[model samples]
Target: MAEKKTPPPNNNRQFAVWGLIILLMLIVFTVAQSGASRPAPGETFTFSDFRERVEASEVQSAKIDIPGGVVTGKLRNGEDYSVNVPPVSADPAGEILDGSGVPYEYAEKTEPSVLANILLSLLPLLIIIGLFFLVFRNMQGGGRGGAMSFGKSKAKLLTENTKRVTFEDVAGVESAKEDLKEVVEFLKDPSKFTRLGARIPTGALLVGPPGTGKTLLARAVAGEAGVPFFTISGSDFVEMFVGVGASRVREMFAEARKHAPCIIFIDEIDAVGRHRGVGTSGGHEEREQTLNQLLVEMDGFEGQEGVIIVAATNRPDVLDKALLRPGRFDRQIEVPYPDIQGREKILEVHMRGKPMAADIDVKYIARGTPGFSGADLANLVNEAALLSARRNKLKITMREFEDARDKVMMGAERRTLAMSDEEKAMTAYHEAGHAIVGLNMEGSLPIHKATIIPRGRALGMVQYLPERDQISQSRQEMIARMAMAMGGRAAEELHFGYDKVTSGASSDIEQVTRIATAMVTEWGLSDEIGPIAYKDTDQQSFHPGIGRGSAISPETAKLIESEIKRFVTEAHDKAREILTDKKDDWIALAEALLEYETLSGDEIKALLDDGTKPKRPDLSGGKRPTVSPVPTTKSSKGPKTIGGPSEA
Candidate 1:
């Protein structure tokens, strides 16, 4: 179908407002200029001087304005003159003029036209009315509300020719797509389902984390079904006025019914669908009212056979129970972050129109990003293209992708950050400790890179790359991770005296504490706290006072805290032991980072294996060395200590 483009609303009303103001200003300016055009009396005289001049036969043809209490005339010498008449004796001025034998008559009193009087009286009221009309017209143009149409639905209609999206445009959530495909199929041909006694679902709720393509999926369903789509936000239905939201809900459903087999998509329904009476101040009456109307419209008394409602929200746990019942939202589809294969598909979709190098491996990029959503992958591709453009490259390559991923994950590198020799050395040693521990510790993830370049909040970083996405971590792996996290602090205390250690290990200490606490309390790793999950007191409760207190008794709480401290202490000691044994290798890696500022996994591995530094590869030519798959091993060094500890 040919797309019809509607012209935008003209701002003629705004121009009219300006024109009215200009006209009023022009009228005032013309009246002031006309008043200034009248001749000024050349000379002023007191009442006595006027009377003397008149009696001396000096006044000639004097004219008196009785209402204004002033007289003007030409003197005998032809000079213009004027005199004031006393308010108490207006008749005296006329008598004096008569006695002077001057040919003078009272100035004729002029009355204004009746039409002018009416127009002057009505001008302000007309300006006020025009202003109100213009303001209301502007409000109506927003399409959300107006002075009189406050209860109208703000849903935007999307036709086939407008913002069309099909299933082919979406990737990475095949299950969600499959579920919605049934809805589309029913809309396409209702007879297929009606004959089999299977009634189509009234609504489906897309539940997921943010940026998982929930809204896009809804649009795709409408496109595939070739039906009209009405898109609105849950917040649009709410207003400060009572009963306004209910009215809007009724109007929206009524409109949807007119176009049968249409889809109505509400984004972020949690904004209005929150559990009633759970707020700090009882509950939001406006939002609760909106949700009530929506619930009724979904499975109301009136038969809405063909209209389908699809809403997206990340916060399904907080939604009202009535909204998720069987009849209202028949399907609750989960749109989670893409797995490895799904991520590759998402990457491919985002990379369609971009110029990519021959060596750009989509699978490799996907593998590196474990918990990335579809939107994240799209951003990654765009960032890579931007990086390539910055370098004046024709196509995005693996190097640009790698740089973009690092920039996204860690943050852009801070090349201009200056550090003193002492600080730089400490940062080098700190990151070196992390790399060495992560590489040699049993069950730890493989170290991808170690760099002393400042990025984000970290002065240096040693990043680990998982071979695959991990669903669960064993106790041994958790212990290894804790030990690795403590390595930086251990190295700092072992090299510099305990008093000289910097706060650079704060993040490492935090990570170690979190891992140890989770292991003991949540994961039930400690035998003393066996197989029990203790609820965290910090968790928020819907009720005012309930669930706010600690679930565990004081004795159990102290025991848990002691166990957490024990786990961290053991991990720290183990890291110190390993660093003491591998002092030479650790020193060599730290010195290498200081010289080169960055080292890849292979370079770090080779440098640790021997004392020799490997030659850096040139990445500017857009060709990168092939990456070998990491061996799936617990540890490669056979648990051997590298060197003897130096004498204190």
Candidate 2:
């Protein structure tokens, strides 16, 4: 069992601050007391009273304390008396004292603040007692509220809200739930498992993308198991001070073991579990120590049996391998994006209390959003509800859902964006080119919609989706998609001259280049490259874009670029050919898009099917055989005034 940590040693800086505060207080108190001890100016006796005493010869020899500005004397009875008087008196008091045969002497008052030293000596004892009380109170709570107890674990032992989550509250992560359900049974009846010579698995790791509810799944296990749950972030285990984080890891594990059969969840565990020897030169030493202690606590000798460690991280690749071994986190469960049915279930769960219209079909919404995670589906439902409320509607309708889906996927429509006629016409033609090519291409995904309305950073967009959920793409299908990416640029070069083409196709060119490059370098799809592929990244590079040298030589690198450029040029020519053959169909779609800013898949397919013929692409030349493309030609589809040689 781990022992509780004492209060951390106070640093010299803390002592300095305390000393300054005490000195300030002493100065203020001493000044206040000294001011209080001085005699007030109004306490002086009248000069007439002084003369009466003098005439009766009751006054003895008098001496003046100049700094105190008071007269000290003894009367006939040898008693002392003092009176407040001006240090420089007028002639009346002086002459009266001189004529009465009283001898007066002037002397300076020597001492100041004598009593302050005595009070100061006694004050430290009281302050010291108060300091001890404050330190004791803080250490009791693990110094969490102050900088002093940084070594104490920052994990929150949640007891108030564990019952709020169970398996029913979690949606769309069925496989991960299945992986964790056995742990609950083991926690409830460990003897049953041990009888069969099987020890309860020590730990389980939840690995997934962000927003996939890894932490929520852990909470559900706690809720179902009826055991204590401790939650802490990975970053909470790290502090600037050395050894503090390691102390915290030991303390956290010890605490969890006390409540047998409990769960300790570390969220985003990658922060302190990065690959060793890769971070800051010496600054990351603290994190490495924390990770080391965590490793020992999870798998070391006398490792607690009933305390199960559960950790969650989106970045499992960066986590220390030692932490992922058998005894530490035996079960590595993956939580991925929801499937179509799973998405529907997630939507149903999120839409429980929403005031939806009677005719709303949740299956349709789920089918439309193919790759949405559970969290994204929830946000979509919320966005739809808010949109309905904004329109002052009593319930959410299908129109609002569609609008919200569009807003979530492709940004909200920028209705107020200003554009000239020329720019709008250019954008319309650009989007129409994509719709035409996508509709005519073989094995192309169905066109979902086309819009010339400005949205996000785009002037126009044509969106498409696979007929069914797809796991992977074939080489031929990727080439077709690359052709689609080039359609916008090809349209510009066809309608406008090569020299007159605008930079509107910048994004399209980038898309085309990226797809073509991947085909050669990563997907191993190029016939000439012959099943060879370069790594997408280097493991040892410190920065994202910087590299020491290529996996291939400089010459081979040039060859890769040439191949990518050739493939992109061929795709552009293919797009031009398809658009040229279906010029009227493309023109009709563009006119429709200009008139109505948004068009659905069915609407787009209807316009293309009015009188269009199917055309097939020539896939005979694998990698194009390094052939030079043909020269330009005059197409009736192209504008006559903007004629120029076609770009190869």
Estimate, for each residue in 317-382, the C-alpha lDDT of model 1 and write its tens digit: 899899999888879999999989999999999999889999999888988888888888999999
RMSD of 2: 9.9
Off by over 4 Å in 2: 1-27, 37-116, 121-148, 160-163, 279-281, 539-559, 610-648
Best by TM-score: 1
Q: Which stretches of candidate 1 lie over 4 Å from their true place?
A: 1-108, 112-145, 279-283, 537-551, 616-648
Q: Where is the poorest 10-residue window by lDDT in model 2?
A: 639-648
lDDT of 2 at 101: 84
Error of model 2, residue 405, in angstroms: 1.9
Q: Report the C-alpha displacement of residue 7, candidate 2, in angstroms.
A: 19
Best by lDDT: 1
For all candidates in order, the CA lDDT equals: 0.78, 0.73
